[model samples]
Target: MTHIRGEVLIRRPVEEVFDFVADQRNEPTYNPDMVFSERVSTGPIGVGSRFRAAVGSGRRPVEMRIEYTAFDRPHLIASTTTMAAAEFSGTLTFKSTPAGTVLRWSWQVRPKGALRLMGPVFGPIGSRREQRTWARLRDHLEAAAKPPLRPGPVPTRFRRAATSHPPAA
Candidate 1:
């Protein structure tokens, strides 16, 4: 069994970050390797929710089924992901900080098929991939939270009317 653990600090409110991560459909937006993800189960997103997703690209992408085992709004989430090559069970905890939110993950991975033979390398690769995935998530969420730039300068004619100094007429 391989274990992966890490934490990421996102510059966004705890509830906002939790909601975005709780929705499986949002995975593809941050994880480049996730080609597609859709919720398969019914009802609101919470415990027992299921999702089907595909990761990687090319002719034979790896398909995965994910299910949430535990959910606590803005605090904790636990899930399992099963794929042809491996299975993973994990928990992600969210903590509100003065700056924003802190998200930490701990996962246990079990390798199967040919991947089982690559025991020594699997942990490192998985660790790197998981780290990169969350880093992208942090960047994506923070960037989206930024206030949009003010509208470009108004047309000269439109600005003239609003300006305190009226054009010499």
Candidate 2:
């Protein structure tokens, strides 16, 4: 088994961060390696919710089925993913921080079939990938938290045009 861990402090409230991370549909937005992800189970997200994701690209893309095993809103979430030659289980814990929310994530991967022999080589690669994923997550969340810039005030002509036509009521 190989273990990978990473943490990030996102400048967003705990509930907002948790909600964003809990939804599998948001994976591709942060994870560059993920090609696409979608919820497979119906209804609100919680324990037992399932998702299917395609990661990587080209001919060797990996298809994974992920299932939520634990869900504690604004606190913790755990999930497991089954791939062709390996199984992955991960837990993400959220804590309120003075600055925002601290997200700590850890995962264990167990290789099967032919992957067992390559575990030594893949372990480090997986660890680096995990770290990069978290960094991207932080960047994405923080960027989203910033308010968009406003245009230097509406043009006088446009503003007057809007007020010129009173409500038809």
Candidate 3:
């Protein structure tokens, strides 16, 4: 068993952070190791929502199924993930702060099959990988938060003269 814990401060609203992280499909945007992620269940994303994802692990891509066990909008989310070699269950807590939002994660990982023999070796590696992944999320959110530049009023000199009809043809 490996227990991994980490936190990251994101300069964004609690609701925004919570919603982005709640949707597993967004993982590939920030987590490079996540090759692909897709929602498998129907309806809105919340408790009981399921997802199918493939993540690059070692030499091959490991496929996993994730399911939400608990969901509290703008506050908390918990889920369990099962893969070929391991199982992970975790909770993400979101808290509002003057600076923005604080996201914390706590996960319990259990290795299965032949991988169980390497449990001690994976604890530290998993911790570091998770930390790096969330840090990228912070960068992604902060960068994405910037509003796109809107076109300014056209300069008077550059504006084409407006006419209701063609001038005298």
Q: Please, what is the whole-model Cα lDDT of each candidate in the order they appear?
A: 0.93, 0.91, 0.94
- Model 1: which ten-residue window has the lowest total lDDT? 159-168
Name the runs in model 3 displaced over 4 angstroms.
147-169
Ranking by TM-score: 1, 3, 2
- Model 3 TM-score, 2 decimals: 0.85
Assess candidate 1 and give its lDDT. 0.93
Candidate 2 vs candidate 3, lDDT winner: 3
Best by TM-score: 1
TM-scores for candidates 1 onward, in order? 0.87, 0.85, 0.85
User: RMSD for each model, in Å, please?
Assistant: 4.2, 6.1, 5.3
Cα-based lDDT at residue 14, candidate 3 = 96
> How displaced is residue 123 in candidate 1, in Å?
1.3
Indicate whether candidate 1 or candidate 3 has the larger lDDT: 3
